[model samples]
Target: MSDVLVIGAGPAGLHAASRALDAGAEVTVLDAHDLVGGQFWRHLPDDRAAADEAQLHHGWKSFQQLRVRLEEHPRCRVLTGTEVWAIEPEEHGAAARVHALSGPSGALRREEVLLTPERLVLATGAHDRVLPFPGWDLPGVFSAGAAQALAKAERVAVGERVLVAGAGPFLLATAASLIATGATVVGVHEAAGPSALCRGWLSRPWELASSARKLTELAAYVTGHLRHRIPYVAGSAVIAAEGNGRVESVRVTRLDRDWRPVARTERDIAVDAVAVSHGFTPRLELAIAAGCAITADRFVAVDARQATTVPGVYAAGELTGIGGMALSAVEGAIAGLEAAGGVIPRQLLAERARQRAFAIRLERAHGIRPGWTDWLCDDTTICRCEDVPFGALSLTEGATQSLRAAKLSTRAGLGSCQGRTCGRTVEEILRQSPGLLGTTTTDQRPIAAPVRLGEFARE
Candidate 1:
């Protein structure tokens, strides 16, 4: 049994494993991908030159340093291409057991490994929060994160001409990356107004001033947008995507301060593909299954020491909230030290508080306004997995409703994705529907990811 088991190899997991090893704990790091760095510092193919790869990823040096240390440390082990399906906490005085299937890409008959660790740190990270719009189910419509992944990992562009739309600083980064990969970015439609940006800057002036590198990066991305002639339109959103089979054009709509579309402000922009994302939602399947307490805002709740309500279970990174890389690293270090029975320094605690405040402000500024549902038409597909349309979700008056009941009636969120893609949208619909007793939450399942029957039999 390992002393500590980190469930992800992202920034949070990497930092946690390193700190735990420093405290004389045996650590095992498992990840679904074949590389150490998560999406942020995705590893380039071996054919790419070291210098070229370094140039593409900003956190190359930090990732390299952590990777080297982890590799050299005798007490640490890193396992890639491993999918954890379930985590079962043991009874009193027994270590928790983690069930996973391990294999190379496209390989069958994966070996099953059961990991027993005294402590578990969850840093499963997050996924793109997609809002439904017409033609979103088109072939060429991809999430902004998916587009960036294609460009970074495979050096492939989503299309010759792309229109990126969303509300957040992430849109800027996505646009910059697409342009770097020889794609013609027609425009970027940001739903939030300029006041959001101004508020973020003014409120977090000290945070911005403290990070010189971040300021430089902001300048660089702004310069790229100017050079590429990509129009970064504020107070606008992609109201609809239009095409026969694939994305060919998008209808952009101007929005008011409350994010309601203004009349006669719709315009058509021709593009081969559309990459849209509102923000990120934490991947809380594993955390929820472990019985961790979540915050009112739906993030996993943790104390300053990064310890969850459950003993011997800690969470960091986006699992706790949608903090950026720096905050994730700090939280991971604190969790790692505490999990390994080490003292958290006072200075570290202060830094975590400061960074967390900035994260909260950022989240508030980019919070999705409820009025975005106006973009959805009665015929728009809300749950693409089950082919459920918006018109099918009609709720009866004065009837107590729940998401599960709606799923039973309309067959929504019952498909392969298991509600990861449309769960948030469905929840919102339920909230707005009249006669609902209260807000509905996602149903928990034993297995976080799908597993083949043969693999289960092997286990």
Candidate 2:
């Protein structure tokens, strides 16, 4: 087994591996993607790469540095296309036993490797969270994350004309990516009203100055919007999408302070495609598998050194919280140093503190509101894979008292995706209903990662 085994190859994972190597440890990194860059640093292939590949991303140079250093290090082994299917929790603060498959999933043969590292760092990152609407299951309706991925990695526009709507700053980034891919963005509708934005942003003035670069990035986005002549509408949202086969148009509506739709402010906009994201939900399967303590807010709980409650295990990036890339990199550095048994620098801790305060501001500014569910109609689909509608969920299935009972009776989270697409939304919908007994948080999956049945036979 290696001294350190880091899961994920995103901004946090890449930096963790590099810092661990620098601390004189032989490190092994496992990433599911064929490329090292996680979702944030996703890019085109070398042959199809942009002349200035760095321009497409915000923190491109730093990602390049960390990736190159790790790849070129003698004590480092970077395994792309390696999916960690399970992490067997250990007692007495021992490293967790990690079971993974090394190769493409559809390959003729795949190798299964199990390792118990001396120190394990998990940076599994987060995924786009979408609120369900009437026509969300349609083909042209895409998550903002998937739309941005297609634009950045494939340089392909999702549609000729598009509309971006969501709560967080990520909508701006998604819109920019779409424009870069030559898509005509008609408008961006932010669900959070001006008061919510001010509470999250304008309340803290001096603290924001510490995050000048973040402001600069936001400015760049605004500048791009002005250049593209895309309208930025605040205090509004796309409450419903309507189309024949795929999404052909969306109904936009003005929202109250709590995101409830105003009665007479409904209007429609015609667009070929729509990208929506409420925010991000952390990927917690690996962290939970490692027996880490999760916070009430659903992020992995970590200490000052970025060490989890469980000894020999550390977590960074979005797993710890939904900060941007800069905060993720800082967290990664701290976790690496602590995991490698190296001392953390005072400056590093200071930077992390600064970044974290800004992360809090972002959360306040863009956190989801309870009234979002008011936008849903009876026919709205909650679990898309199983075709479970909001009305269906409201109907009493045999003794559906709790979240588990609802899942068992209605089969909402038991679809092909195993609740990845609709887990959080379903949980919230059931929790809001007074008919449900005890509202549970998101469901945990034991075999979270996908593995070929053939690989299981080989095992």
TM-score of each: 0.95, 0.97
Per-residue alpha-carbon lDDT of model 2 for 68-158, expressed as tens digits?
Answer: 8888988999998888888888764558899988886668677888888889999999999998877888989999999999999999889
Model 1 Cα lDDT, one tens digit per residue, 1-459: 339989898899999999998888899899988887887777675566346666556677888899889978989989888988898777664346789888875467877878878888999998889899988999999999988888888778899999998877778878887887889999988888788767766674777665555567667789989988888898899989888878888999998877888999999988999888899989898888877888898888998789988788999999998867778888989988888888788987877777677677666667688888888888899889998887777643222277767878887888988888998888887788776665557646578877888777777
Residue 181 accuracy (lDDT) in model 1: 82
Residue 82, candidate 2: Cα error in Å is 0.6
For candidate 2, the TM-score is 0.97
lDDT of each: 0.82, 0.87
- The CA lDDT at 437 in model 1 is 60
Local error of candidate 1 at residue 400 (angstroms): 7.1
